[model samples]
Target: MKSIYFTIALLFFVFLFGCGDETPTKETKDEVVEPVLDYYPDNVGSKWIYLNAEGQILTRTIKEGEEFSGITYKMWQAEPPDAETEIWQAESSDSEAEQVFFRKTIAGIRLYTKEIDKSIMKLIKEDFKPLQGWALFNFTVQSSFTEGLLVELPLKPGLDWLVIHIRAAGTLLGGKNIALTLRFTGHSSRKEIITVPAGTFECIRVTYKYEGKLEIAGEIPSSYTETMYVHWLAPDVGIVQIKDAYGTFQLIEYDLTL
Candidate 1:
């Protein structure tokens, strides 16, 4: 009977305290991380110097943030005021200082707006001088233009998007109709290794093409296309080289420390 009582007491003691002295285990969670795309670096004070097509050195710097229609954008200023002014100055008059604004998101980088002393409307009018058709469009100034998507995120070969579309129509003096359409398109072509004055880099090759269609009664009209600019963008370094009708612009030096 004593042995049985001892066995029962031992069983009760273990049942009461065994689980109480055990340590609790923690529940762990798995974290999901998001990927970041750094196609263009816009840190304030970051500067990039390039040798423009005209054999002239051009410098662009990321300055203070500027606001447009309640939204803020990074201001990019190109020094020496006008590099391609000669191409249109005789027709549009003396050019003025210009600043381009940009905004970035997960989707892509956008041309939020731009600033210029001369009116964009005036420049467009001068392009079609002989016809003298009234210019009607969305943007009076460059800033007035709708947000233009400059680069699409997760870029891959053959990726393309319509950056901007402009249409204008008016009646000419001789009871003839004049119509014009202009489109700016962006394409992510391929990866390339570029060597410039700055150095060599592996970059994403992006091209901007301008397509235009002009129609005037009794005049032959067909759409024409030309490359406005080609950019070799280095990862996190921004544009390393640019090729345009004037010539090629290559990166000479860059300072991204800021």
Candidate 2:
């Protein structure tokens, strides 16, 4: 009887443990986390094409780096050039409407200014050929195009900062002195999902306030101020849409050759 009881107890224990082991296991799926996007990805050979409301096409490309005063700068060029030959004619490209060199700095992305004087001298040689003999405008800049932060990193909503402040005084025609003051303020507004011709993008909305004061030293001084808040920048994608006084430009295509 003891042997029979022992056998029955052993069998019950085996049945309980064996049944527990035979229970079906639940399957689990791995969760995928998306990558964090950079506000501005400055990879070389990256190109972006935009189409305006007026059917005008704009193209911007990130070209090779150029060395200036021991510092290398990435060149960003825009097509359909908007040349400002009247005052500041310093430029790195003759074919593009706008070409700006940028280098990373502790403060932010700074404008490369080592070649400013060189480009200005070149402009004097070509456009201002007559001013080569003597300095017509004793031009002095408190902070011109030399060092301006393009975009502040780790952008967050409601963040605002002074982008650039430029105060310059120059004499034109060797008599009349002109003074100019320009200030730019940037603000990171919010996060949005927007769709353009290029595609859909999760972007950060940014805005800039531009203020200009011009004194001609004779006529009525003029002051201009405007706030542009329609810039949509996608993470790892760059500028996706822009709306200004002219018109709206939507990203049509982009190639990021990172």
Candidate 3:
């Protein structure tokens, strides 16, 4: 729980200050073939290592390439593989940041959602089938798309997008329930030179704000937590650096086979 909490607080920061940028990808919306976004690399075998503010390091690797329903996805996970790690999806896009599909497994059950849009990534949609004791605390949910966004695309300095997300869930017995709705309004245009273990390069700084509501058992909580993120993305290399209050995930090594 501590690790999950830490990641949530950390990634939220990556969304607020720096995320997307100005480099035009090699592929655009003009072709019949898959347009590979130049700014984001989806090749298999790609790897990234980041050193946090406290000197602790986090690592991710593109284990393989996968295709789903005619769309290709680059599978990413921690350096040392584990069972609980989830696989994220990014469709082919030459201009905008690909929407990510969230997926993972817990205990011994599988769970995931299906919301397809190149610019949308639906989070917190559903939980895997319930076990004997897990369902009492968890709920099931359906669909809620406030709207998607435009990211990893070519932006001059002040372009933004409003991305929506909705999640619903219920207990195994269908008594208790939980739901959440969030809209992330993001804008970016700052550019900076970043140096990591991989190399030094110009990166687009993306930052954004998140606002939404949360409901559990049809009741709103008295207190709510805010979320934000700042990502330093390097064109041609993908996300080279992620920053937050705790530390940083700076790219130390990578292998994106063109």
| TM-score winner | 1
> What is the alpha-carbon lDDT for the whole of candidate 2?
0.61
Ranking by lDDT: 2, 1, 3
| Model 1: lDDT to the true structure | 0.61
Q: State, as a TM-score between 0 and 1, how close model 2 is to the true structure.
A: 0.66
lDDT per model vs. reference:
0.61, 0.61, 0.46
| Pairs in steric clash, model 2 | 81-97
Clash count, predicted structure 1? 0
lDDT of 1 at 95: 28
Decide which is better by TM-score, 1 or 2: 1
Estimate, for each residue in 172-223, the C-alpha lDDT of model 1 and write its tens digit: 5556676666666788888899999889998889987667676767989767
Candidates in order: C-alpha RMSD to true structure: 24.1, 24.4, 11.9
Question: In model 1, which residue pairs have backbone atoms overlapping below 3 Å?
Answer: none
Give candidate 2 misplaced runs (Cα > 4 Å).
Answer: 1-36, 82-92, 105-107, 113-139, 170-178, 214-222, 228-230
On residues 1-258, what C-alpha lDDT tens digit does candidate 2 reach at each position? 223212111111001123344546453124364454576777889998988878998787888767876778887776753221111222445653567777654445566643444533333323322533324356665644555565676555676777666565667674777666666677878789999988999888988666667676677987776663357888878889976544778999999985
In candidate 2, residue 47 scores what lDDT?
90
